[model samples]
Each structure stands twice: as structure tokens, then as C-alpha cells.
Target: MGKLLIQGGIPLEGRVPISGAKNSTLPVMAACFLAQGETILENIPEITDVDVVMEICREMGGEGEWLERGVIRLHVPDTISCKTSYTLAKKLRASNLLLGALLGRFGWAEVALPGGDNIGTRPMDLHIKGLSVLGAELKIEHGYIRGGVAGGKRLKGGKIYLDFPSVGATENIMMAAAMAQGQTIIENCAKEPEIVDLANFLNAMGARIRGAGTDVIRVDGVSELRGTRYTVIPDRIEAGTYMIAAAATHGRVIVENVIPTHLHAITSKLREIGVRVEEGDDQIFVDGAGLFRPVDVKTLPYPGFPTDMQSPLMALLSTVKGISMIVENVYENRLRVVDELQRMGAQIKIEGRTAVIDGVARLSSAQVKASDLRAGAALIIAGLMADGETEVSCLHHVLRGYAHLEEKLTGLGARVRRIS
Candidate 1:
């Protein structure tokens, strides 16, 4: 594991180009199996999670190579292995997405139960339920999800109503429904931008998908999908993380190559906290030198405050001059970072799903450990604004999502370096 040594008290300034969305790229990469021939994907983020997904793809007899920076050429085989090893599938939660693509193409899939961040209890019941509704027999036996259509049958699409707007379930079902026998109607689906991106990628490859950015998503099954060149969307969570880092340090940063509409929830919150956010065609300029006001935040489904951003936003709130309340409705254990923040002079209290933060004048440096991906990001934001040097350990968590994190922070004028 690597560590990040950061000297605080520098206002980040300059343009930081956002990387491709990890959430979007993972599913799109898995969707490559739905089609044969070479499928080119641009704007692929160089992150551990993406690499892991690609490794899984290669293990299944598919070929993948990086044509250039942030570009990948993937060649899907006519037939791929139906089983994914536990060692590979346990690397990330996105591995669950492969089940849909594999089942859609091969009528069978045996994947291990996924392992990712320890944020909360992320159950696979929804994923199993959705696929079962689409005519697949699924069973969890000895930490593996073994699923297949009996008698070499293809999945037949049907109506699936999610108990919760689970993004993983929505993406998994959509990928399976893309090549199913008939139309699939998914109600109360997640409306995240990544979901829309996956839908667009599948559509480019000849899948009839509609109502992506809404609660109701309709997927008209096709016989088979063809290969097509597609580009992933910018990482909104990464862009928001940088925006919050800039805001915490009272800096000015222009986050480029992002869709402004996708960040309305984040930008509006920043403005509410007295930060200046100016939106452009594909960029957002954040100026955070003004006095910040404490605001209440509630994490909800898409078009609302994202749960992934709760930790970093809370770090920003730690430096404000008043009390703030954050309600994390998405994940139960997301408040795990509050203890680490408190070690750095933050006044915080967690009561069930709610967190009460009493903002202080400034925070002093401390040796902190990151427990999860977003928690690592929150610690980085805190380190950037601390009074002295801060050493952040467990950097592997951060590298799982953010691409070129230290380099990007350096480009923005922050003093940050990786220590092996």
C-alpha cells in the first residue's frame, strides 16, 4: 500500500480535466461481451477497478489492449468461459455486472459474490431477483452466485420492479435484458448518469433502450448486438470531489470535460455553502474563498445529493464556521469517516443515519487511515486543508477510483506526493 504526504494551506488553482466515469466504464466494458468483434472505448479511466474488470474480461477468453491513454480496444470472443474465478470476481463490486452480460450471451454464468468497499450492507438480492424475473435460475451456494437458463435456453424479458433504486441491479438487469427474447420493463430504476451512459452505449451497439434518466426504463430485447465505438462520460463524482477539495481549501479550480447538468445537485450545494460555481458548456469553475454557511444535506437517488459524495462534502463542512447536518440515506456505515475526521480536530457526532458537524476554524495535520474509497477521498480533502503536513495511508482505496490523483492535485498547485 502507498501513502500520500500532503502539505496543507495551498489553494488549488488551474484546470483539472475529469477522467472517464468508473461507474460508467465498468458496465460498458462488461456490455462489450454482448457483442462480437472489436469494440473501441475512448476516455477509459486508468484505475485499478477498470483494470480488474479488464483482467476479468481477458480471463474469459476476450482480448483487451490499451490503444492509447484513456482508450481501450476490446475484442469479444464468439464464446467465452461461463465461470469467473473467485479471486477475480471478489476484487470489485462491478464484477456483478458481468453476470448479466455473460448470461445474456451464453445462457449461463457462475460468478462469486462481489467484494468492494465496506461502506454498508450492499445485498445481491435485487440483482438475483431482477435476473430471476427475466427467466434465469439463480442460487447462492458457498459464496458463489451460480445462475443459468435450463436446457440451453435464452433469457426472456419481463417486467421487473426494484424494491429500491439500486444502481447495480438496474445496470445488471439492463445488460441481460438487452439480448433477452422480448421487451423488459424496469420500473423504479436508478436514474444516475452512469446508468444513462450504459444505456447509451448499449443503444449504440443496437440495443433498444429508452427512458434511461428516469424511473421507468424500457429495454426492447434484440437477437444480438453488434460492436461499436463508444466514449464514456466524465466522472461526476471525481469532478465533485475536486470541487469539494477546492472549496475546503478556499481555492479556485476549473473542473473541465464534465456535463454541467449532471452536477446540479453538487453545484447547488456548493452555492448554498457560499461557494461560487459558474457552469460552462462542459466545465465548471469553482471559487471557494467566501464565507461558508452550514447547510443540511440528504443523500438520495439520482438528481439528488449522491451518497458517494457525502464523505468529501462532509470534509468541506468541517472547515465551515457553523453547524451542519448530513443525513446519509443511502448507506448505513458511510459515517465511518467521521471518526477519522474527528482525529483531525473536527467536531462531529453520528446518530444513526444522521451526522451533526460543528465546523471549526481550521484543522491540524494528523496521520489518518482510509477505510473505504470515498473515505480516502474525504481524508485527501481534509489533508489538503490542514495546517501542516498530513500523511494518508491505505492509498489503494483511493487509487481504485481516482485516476492520477497526486498528479492532478499537483497540477492544481497542491503539495501532494506519493510515498511508497
Candidate 2:
């Protein structure tokens, strides 16, 4: 593992370009397997998760090569192994996505149970239920999800209603239904920008899908999908993290290469907290010199405050004038960062799903460990605003999502470096 040493009290000022959405890239890469020929994906983030996905793809007989710094070309074969080893599948949670693509293409898949950040109980019940509804027989055997169509028949599309708007389940069902026999309708689907990107990528590859950024999505089963070039959307979560970092340090930063409309919830919440946000065509300029105020935030589905941004925003709220209440409705253990932040002198209380934070004037540096990806990001923001040096361990979690995090922070005038 690596650690980051950050000297605090620097007002970050510069332009920070956001990378491609990691959430979008993973599902899109998995969807590429459903198509024949070559698929060129642009603006792919250089993260550890993506590398692991590429490795999994290669293991399944797909050839993936980096065309450029942020571009990848994947060539899918007509036939591929439907089984993924436990060692590869346990690398990241997105490994579950392969089940959908493999089941769609070959009508059978044997994938090991996925593993990811120890945030909470992220079950695969929705994924299994959705695929089972589409005429695929699914069962768990020896910690592997074994699924296939009975009688060697093709999947027949059907209606699927998710108990919750699970992003992984939505993406998995959509990909599996793309090659099914008939029409598939998904209700209460995830409407995040990443879902829309995946839908667009599938459409570009000749899959008939509609209502992507809405509550209901319809997919018309096609005979086969052909490869095409597609560009991914900007990482809104990463952009929101940088914006929160700027505000926490009383800095000015321009986060570029983003979809301004996709970040309405984050921008509006920051504005309500007394941060000046200037929106442009594809960028947002955040000025944090104004007076900061406490604001209540609730993490919900898209179009609401994202659960992914909850931690970083909490770090900013720690420096505000009064108390701020955060309700994390998506993940149960997202408040794991609260303990790390409290070590730096921030007063926070956790009661079930809500966290009541009483802002302090300033925080003192302390050594902390990141328990998850977003928690690691929150610690970075806290370190940038602290009095002295702060050391953050568990760098692998941060690297799994953010691309060149230390370099980006250093470019924005924050004193950050990685130590092995």
C-alpha cells in the first residue's frame, strides 16, 4: 500500500480536467463483448478498476489494447470462455457485469461472486432476479453465479421491476436484454448519467434502447450487435470531489471537461452552502472565499445529492460555521469517513443513517486511513484544509477511481505527494 503526505493551508487555484466516468467505462466495456468486430472507446479513465476489467476481458478471450493515453480498442471474438476465475472476479465489484454480457452472447455464464470496497452489504439479488425474469435460469453454486437459458433456447425478454434503482442491476439487465428474443422493459431503473452513456454506447452498437435517463427503459432485442466507436461522459463524481476540495480550502478552482447539467445537485448544494459557482458550457468555476454556511444534505438517486459525493461534502461541511446534517440513504456504512475526520478535530455524530456534524473553525492534521474510495477522497479534501501535515493511507482505494489524483491536486497548488 501507498500513502499520501499533504501539507495543508494552501489555497488551490487552477484548472483541473475531469477524467472519463469510471462507472460508465466499466459497463460499457462489458457491453462491448456482446458485439462482433472492434469497439473503440474514447476518454477511458486510467484507473486500477479499468485495468482489472481489461485483464478480465483478456482472460475471457477478448483482445484489449490501448490506442492512446485515454483510448482503448477492444476486439471481441465470436466465441469466448463463459467462465471467469475467482481470482479475477474478486478484484472488483464490476466483475459482475461480465455475467450479463456473457450470458447475452453465449447464453451461459459461470462467474465468481464479486468483491469490492467493504462499504456495506451490496447484494446481487437484483441482478439475479432481473436476469432470471428474462428467461435465464440462475442459481448460486460454490460461490459462483451459474446462469444460462434452459433447453439451449434464447432469452425471451420480459418486464423487470427493480426494488431499488440499483445501477449495477440496471446495467446488467439492459445488457442481457439487448440480445434477448423480444422487447424488455425495465421499471424504476437507475437514471444516472453513466446509465445514459451506456445506453448511448449500446445504441451506437446497433442495440435498440430508449428512455435511458428516465424511470423506465425499453430495449428491443436485436439479432446481433456490431462494434462502434463511442466516447464516455465526464466523471461528475470526480468533478464534485474537486469542487468540494476547493471550497473546503477556501480556494478557487475551475473544474473542466464536465457536463454542467449532470452536476446540478452538487452545484446547487454548494451554492446553498455559500460557495460561488460559476457555470460555463462544460466547466464550473468554484470560488470559496465567501462565508461558509451549514447545509443539510440527503443522498438519494440521481437528480438528488449523490451518495458518492456525501463524504467529500461532509469534509467541506466540517469547516462551516454551524451544524450540518447528512443523511446517507444509499449505502449503510458510508459514514466510515466520519471517524477519520473526527481524528482531525471535527465534531460529528452518527445516528443510524444520519450524521450530524458541528463545524469547527479549523482542523489539525492527523494520520488517518481510508476505508473506501470516497472516504479516501474525503480525507484528501480534509488534509488540504488542515493546519499541518496529514498522512492518508490506503492509497489503492483512491487509485481505483481517480486517475492521477496527486498530480491533479499538485497542479491546483495543493502540496500532495505519494510515498511508497
Candidate 3:
């Protein structure tokens, strides 16, 4: 059992480096299954999700070990197995990534359904539909998602129009298509940076991937893929959460080792709330300007306001000047964090899917629990803004995505300490 004890009202000031994207590293790790030899992945975040992904690979007859702080060396044998462990598969939602990797390498797969932080119902129907398009036979029995790609079956690539541009579906489809017998075009594909990172990883492995950071992507199937070293992109959600922390606590902080393009949405929204955001080539500086002002925001897909950022943004808005309305377009139950925020005396009301947040002058210290990953981020920001010592439980959810969050906040002069 672990908790974060945060003393509020400190002006967090200093530089904090953002770690590798959990979103990017998980799928990149999954793509190692396509390789026959050793692959080196750099900037791998030391998070719980990565541990789960590593276990998945180890169970699938692959060997992996961390060479450096954020580097992983993995070797998937020439003959890979299609069967995966049910216990490992269900530990992390990203384990479903094995479907495409297994299909690409062995043309078959049998894995359990994914499980992780319970934000909402993240159905895998889109993944199934895209796999079916890539010529896979799938069936749901009991609690497992069983599928095979080689029952005298040919995965001939074709045009796939997704009903929704879900990120997971797009990545899985792209991975499978990269090894198909023909060209594959995915329409309305997810344009998230994580998807682009996955594309870059596949391309590095001798797969032809084009137009990744767009609505449509094209993949030309190759006979085989070779292993190579890849560096994962920095995490934008972690950067956004720290940005909100700086502004909420009336602090000045510089977040480093980030992609400026990936953080455009979060920076734009923060500036709207009177927080000063200065962007450099690989870093961003945020400063609280005297008092914060309220700003209305709506969560959308990539290049728009991201759903992953809504929680931290809500925490910043809790003590701003006026009321702010936020519409969550991505997840159905993302507003569940509002209960934890209310524990700190923040006035917020959830109506259906939208949340109306009334900013108060201050938030009193209170104990709160994290319901999910992003919710943990929101609670941490709330603790940073509270008037006294605030306690946050469920540090496991926070550890899943963030890497050394407490240490970084401490560098920024925040009174944050981890208690186990």
C-alpha cells in the first residue's frame, strides 16, 4: 500500500523531464514479435504497463531485459508461438496488441481479453473487424479472444473504413496489414502520436508504412521484417499533467524532452486559462500569472483537445475565476474523477456526459482515491492545489503511466513525497 502526501501552496519551479510515452512503448514492444532476432528499444518508460508488456513478451517465448534506465533489449526467437498466457494477457489492455503481432509473425493467435484501469467500456470490436478484413478467423468464447490467421487463409490487404478512429484498432490493423500479401489502405485511422510512433517502429523494421499522422494510412505488405533499434517518443499526457500542476499551484516549471507538436492541444488550453506557456524545440515552460482564469474546453481526438488531458485540466480549473464546461467526447465515464475533485471542496456537477466546473478561490486539503490512471493524475493535481496536506491513494494507477512523478514534482519545489 502506497500514498502520496502533498503539501500545497508551494510555487513549483524548475525543470522536469518527461519520460517515454506509455502509449508508444507498449505497441512498439508488441511489434518485437515481428522480428526474428534481437531488437533494442530506447526510452522505454519504467511504468507498470511496460512491466506487463514485458511479461507478455517473456510468456510468448521472447527474452527481454533492460540495459539502461529506459532501454529494453528484446530477442524473439525465429520460431515464435501463437499462444499467449491468459493471466499475462488480461493484466494490461495493451496485451491485445499481440493479436496483430502474432498474426503478422505466425499468422495465428489465441489470447485473453485485456484488462487495466477501469475508465469505461473499451470494446475491441473495431480490432476484430479490422482483423477480419485482414483475413482472420476470430471467436469470443468464455473470457478469451481466440483467433487464427492460417487455416489455409490468406491475408490480402484491402481498403478498411473504420467506424470510429480508435487508436488501438488502427495500430492492430496497421501491424497486421504490414505483413499482408498485398497493399492495405486504412481510412479514418487514428492520427495520434502514439500511432505515428508505432508506424515509425514498423517502418524501421522493414515494413512500408505511410501517412501515419493522418486520417488515412497506407501499408504495403512485405515478405518479412528485420529487427532494429528504435527510440520511443516522449509522453504527452505526462507532460500535460505536469503543465497543469505548474499552473494550478501558482508555479513556474519547465517540462523537457517532449515533442512540441504532441503537446499543442494541452498548451493551447492552458494558455486560454491565463497560464503562460512558452515552447522551445524540446521543452515547454509554464507559469502561473498571478491568478488563474476559467476557460471552457471540450475533449476530442488527437490534434484536438485530448481525452487524456481532461482530468488534469479539470484539476487546474477547480480554483480558477469562473465556471468552465468540459465535454468528454472520447470516453463515457471519464467524469468519474469529479467525485475525487469534490472531496477537495471544488464545486463541480456532472450532467450526463458533460461536467460543469465552478472555480473557487481555493481548495481545502482532503483525502482522495484514484479510480483510474488519468483520475490519479487529476487527484495529484488537486493535492498540489489544496490548502494543506492532501493524501492520494491508489498510487499503483499513477505508476502505470507516469515515471518518477514525485521526484519530478519535488524538483519543481513541490512538497510531494511517496509514502508506502
Candidate 4:
């Protein structure tokens, strides 16, 4: 909808607050369907994706509104629609979560195939397999994923083993299994912090779940769930972005409102690169004015280097000395940002899923496009380090994930402004 014009060569120095995790908030909003009453969710980020979820909830006969800044008051009636329209569902990848929540609540659900960033093919097979094991007769009919229990029977709990520990699959199955008739055990589950947040919120709403932060999770089905207030964890992806941005600009920054443990992978990488990283109880300080070294990064499931931070990390590596390699073990097309970075004088070569980057002494300013959410963050970081003004287009993708991006960067003393 707009573009960000940023002047480069200024070291940012200030405090930046991380928002509530978008990954956590979306699934938690879908999980709210299982509870029939007013559920107050605090620490909600004011992002467009939240608006999309609120719209989807209303379309399904649930009512929600912003009670105040960073707060949402949602009320789900006893009876609600079990189908989500393609127009709404296709706007967000997280819409697939409705399949499990609706099926768990009403034994029937019809949701369109999801759409979000076109990084690569993110199959729904894991989600389908996990739900099928729990006794939901799901199938892809026409364009929508539709089906449920055949005989008006509640979903029966069973054991499921995911070949890949997909975060979405883990969350969908967990929500559906929460209302099943017996205990459900999911082995090889994703152990992300967002998964733990979802489990905590569900447990607060009277669902019995344990071992959430581990590879095996146990969910004891409950007859019904009541509404409750819950706060989501801070977004580690956002926190990592700011941390990398500080290092890329040679700025000293303190990122607040974060769980230091959730960012272990990011902090470890920065330290290995010779950046000064100091961790506090709930914050992290990064000093970037030091000699930089090269390091290799490979994306993996939780507790590993997150794919979301891959682009931003590459942006930092582009300015380092020597050669650095990045292997994209998560999404195949996520390296699309390489073309834009190359326009700014970066030397990078892609071989299959791996990127071999040769550090450049400096990057000149150039006009670039943001192909996706994280890619946009990478471009912004590149702009902050370049010699002149840089214009970043495709602003909608950036707005979808980041909240108050220009304001936050400006507060850090960077010259950033939004233009149409």
C-alpha cells in the first residue's frame, strides 16, 4: 500500500519493545472457538493479520472487538457456523487451524485451503494425518477441506506420530484433541515456544494438556471449556529482527519485552559472529561496533535456527568479512530476497537449498521489493546499512507481520518514513 524510505549509515541507539507473537495469537484465536463465552486476550499486537482473524471469527458468528490497545474481547456463542468462506480463509495460512477447532467444537468443519507467503509448498498432509488418527473423517472436497465424524459422534482420541514436527499440524491436532473423548498422545510434536503458549492458553480455559514444551504432548479431552483471560508470549521473530538490525547498522540497542530463552538460537549466532550480546532477565542488549566474523546457519525445527530469521541473518552476513553459508532447510523459495540484496551490491550465489555469501565491504542504496514478510525485514535491515536512501516496496507484506515498524525504527534514531 506504501513504501518505506530509509536513510542509511546511522547507528540506531535506543530501546525497542517486541510485540506479542503473531504465530501464537492466530492459533490461540482459533482455539477460542472451543470456549463459549467472553475470552479476554491481552498483549495482542495491532497487525493486519489480527484483523483478518477477527473478521473470520465474525463471519463464523462469533463477536470480537478491541476493548483497548493491545487487548481483544471475544465472545463465541454456543451455536456457530462450521464453515469459513474462501474469501476470508485464503487470506491467511493460519485459517487452516479452523478445521481442527470447528471439528472439535461441532464435529463438522469446512475450510478453504489456506494462502499466505508463497515461500514454497507447505503441504497440509501432516495436519490431515494427525486429525484422521483422532477419528475425524476429513477430505478435500471441491476447494474446501471438509468433513468430520460420520455418525454425529465426538472425536475419539488416539496416538499420532508426525513424520515432520510441523508447528501448524501440532497446534491443529492439539486443539482438536482437547475436546476428544479420551486422552490423545502426539509424538514428534513441534517444541516451539508458540506451541507452549497455545497449550498454556488452552489449559487456562480448562483443557488438560501436559508436556507441551517437549517432543511428546499429552492432551486429556474435556467435555467443555470455559472462557478465560490469557496473555501471549512476546514474538521472538520480531525480537531477533531488531537484534540483527542493530548489528547490521553497527548500533547499540536494547530489545525489551522478550523471553531471553526463546531467542537462544539467535543470540548464539550473534555471539559467534563477534557481536556483543548481553542477556538480561527479559531483555537483550546488542553492541555491533566490533570486528565481524563469518558463521554458517542451517534452519531447522524449534530450538534450531528459525527460518523466519534466516533472511535477516543473511542481511547481516552480507556485510561481514570472509565467506558465510546459509542452508534453507525449511522453505525452498525463501531465498527470493537474494535478488534484491544483489541489487545493493551483495555477492551471493545459490546452489539448490544453500546460499553461499561472500561478504562485501559496503552495500550501496538501491530500490528493492519485499517478496514476503521476513524478506521485508531483511530489506529494511539492508537499507539501514547502505550508504544512501533506500526505498522498499510491497509494503503490504511487511505490514502484515510487523506492528508500528516505522515508529519503532524511528524511535531507535533511524531515519525511516512511510510514503505512498
Each candidate: RMSD: 0.8, 0.8, 1.2, 0.8
Which residue ranges in model 4 land beyond 4 Å of their true spot? none
Give candidate 3's total backbone clashes: 0
Give per-model TM-scores. 0.99, 0.99, 0.98, 0.99
Candidate 4 lDDT over residue span 52-126, tens digit each: 989988988999899998999888898888888889888789999988888888999999999889988899999
lDDT of 2 by residue, 253-319 (tens): 9999999999999999999999999999999999999998899999999989999999999999998
The 0-to-1 C-alpha lDDT of every candidate, in the order given, reads 0.93, 0.93, 0.88, 0.94
> On a 0 to 100 scale, what is the lDDT of residue 36 in model 1?
75
Off by over 4 Å in 3: none
The TM-score obtained by model 4 is 0.99
Better of 1 and 3 by lDDT: 1
Model 1 TM-score is: 0.99
Clashes of each: 0, 0, 0, 0
Which 10 consecutive positions of candidate 2 have the poorest summed lDDT? 147-156
**Lowest-scoring 10 consecutive residues by lDDT in candidate 3?**
147-156
